[model samples]
Target: MTRHPGTNRTAQCVVCGRAFPLPKLRKIGQLRPGLHEMIAAEVADCGAESLICDEDLAHYRRRYVEKLLAEERGELSELDRQVLDSFEKGVSTVQSSAASVLDRNPTFGERTADRVASFGGSWTFILFFMGVLFAWMALNVSGLFAVPFDPYPFILLNLVLSCLAALQAPVIMMSQRRQEEKDRRRAENDYMINLRAELEIRQLHEKIDHQMAHQWERLAELQQIQIDLLERRGDTQRG
Candidate 1:
């Protein structure tokens, strides 16, 4: 937040030609005292004395990032393209949970199957059904009804059990199939997330490398500037 002295308090941007507050404009000198000269000489051609507005600065930053990525990856993937696009557009790359989105719109059959599978797999169902079977046997064998509805071998009970089994097996299988599908989708989402994260990390490394190289170059230039200044002082003092 360095303040620059100006009567009008406005500076015209070299790139866009728009007037912005002197404090708001990023002076070419302020970017990097040494590297700015190289950038102005090599890339921007602005002669080391220029001002850029926030918009143009952002544009240059994005271009720098893209250049680094291009040099590293050689070609952009769709995912890489999307990530760079998001950076340029100032949009967030993070996404909502895919599992939540998938769960939000379940069909009636899916819901029913899940519920049936959960209930059928529980100990409560097992214990209650066992109790019912015991009661049926007791009532028939004790002759509580004068004539047993299911005689000794319990043929009627066997038919009921067979029908229940026939129905429950399919419901559990349907639920398991839906679960497998969900797991597959979740794995795909996880892979995508991990890939995106790796790309971002790689891009970040590129940025850091670019900055380190730029800083090293800048340091060399600063040392040269200091040497020239000392030489000039020595000559002036001798005179």
Candidate 2:
């Protein structure tokens, strides 16, 4: 209700008791009843004429969201905390890219594993290895050299294949583990985005409802004023 001594352009915030431009302040009467009650619970002396700055209103809005989340979920996860923090900070919860969640500087071993996994799963690797196997068997069985290095049964080739399988299995597994981590991070990012959107929608509904209620109150006041004016005119005529 209070303003700066020399200017009517500013109003005092009930919560902070600081003067702010009227455009930056909101009257308590215009707020949704639930939010108004929340403010009243905290600020005992605040009334319909009290004004709250945008910053204070946003703080209360955050608290209201937190309360709603707590009532529904009982306990908040790290993801929820992250979403709430970003909401309060007025920042987007989205990542720049899906891969942005991955470590920027992967270790040499991890990089090598990923490369090996990528190549091993490709059709080129399968066809190239098939040709190599055919050539090795043909050279050994057809006596192409004086004494084939791999001989008839190709024991050396078997050993080579065994070692490749052993090494490739672990490398592919490492790569898969990294991929699983990336998927988990992507899921978390999605969850945060959805939660923020839901909260924003809820806030929008609250604002719309409050606006409609305020309009109704204004219409009612106008009707009452018209009735009083008509009563006064009738009385004056009778007199």
Give the C-alpha miss distance for residue 170 in model 1, angstroms. 0.9
TM-score of each: 0.61, 0.87
Scored against the true structure, residue 14 in model 1 reaches a CA lDDT of 72
Clashing pairs in 1: none
Runs in model 1 with CA error above 4 Å? 1-101, 236-239
Candidate 2 Cα errors over 4 Å, as ranges:
95-100, 103-107, 230-239
Q: How accurate is candidate 2 locally (lDDT)?
A: 0.87
> How accurate locally, in lDDT, is each candidate?
0.74, 0.87
For residues 1-239, what per-residue lDDT tens digits would candidate 1 score against the true structure? 22344677887777676788976687675563333544565544464357777777766656666666689879866656655655656555544355575768888999999999999999999999999999999999997898899989999999999999999999999999988978876765665566556656765776577668778989999999999999999999999
Q: Which ten residues in a row have the lowest lDDT in candidate 1?
A: 30-39
